[model samples]
Target: MSLEVTVVQACLRSGRGGSRTAVVEDGDLSDAARRTVPGAVGASQAVFIAAQDPAAVRLRFFTSTGELPACGHGTVAALAVLAQRSGNDRYDGVLHSTTRSLPGHAIGNAGHYSAAFEPGPIDLRAATIEEADPILSALRVSAEVAGCHVASVGRPRLLVELADRQTLANLAPDMPTLQAVTDRLDLLGCYVYVTPSSDGHTVARMFAPSIGVPEDIANANSTACAAAHLSTRGHSKLQVDMGDSLGQPATMTATVTGSPGTPIVEVGGTATISGRHHLD
Candidate 1:
């Protein structure tokens, strides 16, 4: 298949885009970086990257299975392009992105080199023991999880609040077993969160062994907002740190009044562009 790609050189600042705006389309996105990064198509295929800004980004990888809801790295790359195109303070309004605009669930903002797109604020609600079992096994998260809930915005993330930052950072799941479990259960992926004893920001890691993407996502925009959306009901200001684990170490900040169920959830952060390229 011929691969269609749009490359942009850009920067990202903060506070931009709503929840369903901004998009980029790549005719062919390979799964090379899957698992190592938070988001992206798992196999070689056509991909659509859409964002809501400073908060959530969703990716629909048209696959044999169906349209995959979210992709992390692809979101980062798209924001890089948006940021490069519009530099400076917040950028709003309906603008043409690298890909064609998607109606309903698409809107966003731009910054120096950073862009944040929101999705329907992350909502953490209920889940059954059977639904939660696979995740526990996948992350090798043998112990029990507190404040566990079914979370989603762009992509479905099983939010598991660990005991401490130690457990959050030290996620050692059996990839083979976890993947088998999630696939059978029909889940997109799993993300674990933890609040530090004393904080600057929130720390989290995602494992989607089922879809074949492993641990480590630099900074998944959608997942970042999802985590914040879950915390706002009880806390204020969520700072997310996902460094080398996902390839690019970055920070995402979310401030709002509710978690997932709130009427509104806004997320913002700095996005830095590595560079640009013209696909061959």
Candidate 2:
């Protein structure tokens, strides 16, 4: 059997660079089959739309390594494709996945789409020196770190804050060592970022070799983790800039509401349907 896959680039910067994700609208595919789509299409992740209705849409996410409980960019890409196919400029519904269900909305305009959704629960905590030392060694960085914490927006990511953008840009992690550290810590990936600029924009990058992603062009869930970490420090809204190292520059917006220790985070970004693929 052959499956048609729609390629979408989410979290684009000026309609140019973003993460390329494959979206497949098939309900009958097994977990094993879904895992093959990403590798076959040269994409890091694939989203399967198992079912849809006027009120809700069910989605499943996968990487070449295995299935994921949730995915931020994949969710945005899937919602954009669904809105376009429905011939509507706007779509409002719930996104159901194996791990959680989130209220989501998408807007399509002039061949571009913006999608946002509430992620799962938020958890943030400071990291001990023992936890931080191994990761820092793997990253091969001795620069002064401003803050170190473990954060989660359904998925756990080690959020490391550097003193300046220069330090953040100079990162060259040992992928093998970093992967081992993530596995030991039971983390999804490591998110290294600089402090927010005066205008409330942050620059960052993500690495998750344990999940077969050596470097992510744009990581929405990690962005949410950053938002949650900063919200505790009195930041309510901010934009995250990522993907520059690999040349696929991307931007994602994160809004934090409610209060500290229990903040609500919403992640969103624009995406375009770049092309398609046929998976056998």
Best by lDDT: 2
lDDT of 2 by residue, 73-138 (tens): 999998888888878889787889887887888898655899998886777889988888999999
lDDT of 1 by residue, 201-266 (tens): 567776765554565443354454554545554555566665435344555665555434554544
> What are the clashing pairs of model 2?
none
Q: lDDT values of the candidates? A: 0.49, 0.88
C-alpha TM-score for every candidate:
0.66, 0.96
Per-prediction count of colliding residue pairs? 39, 0
Candidate 2: segments with Cα more than 4 A from true spot = none
Error of 2 at 263 (Å): 1.1
Q: Give Cα distance to truth, residue 114, candidate 1, Å.
A: 3.2
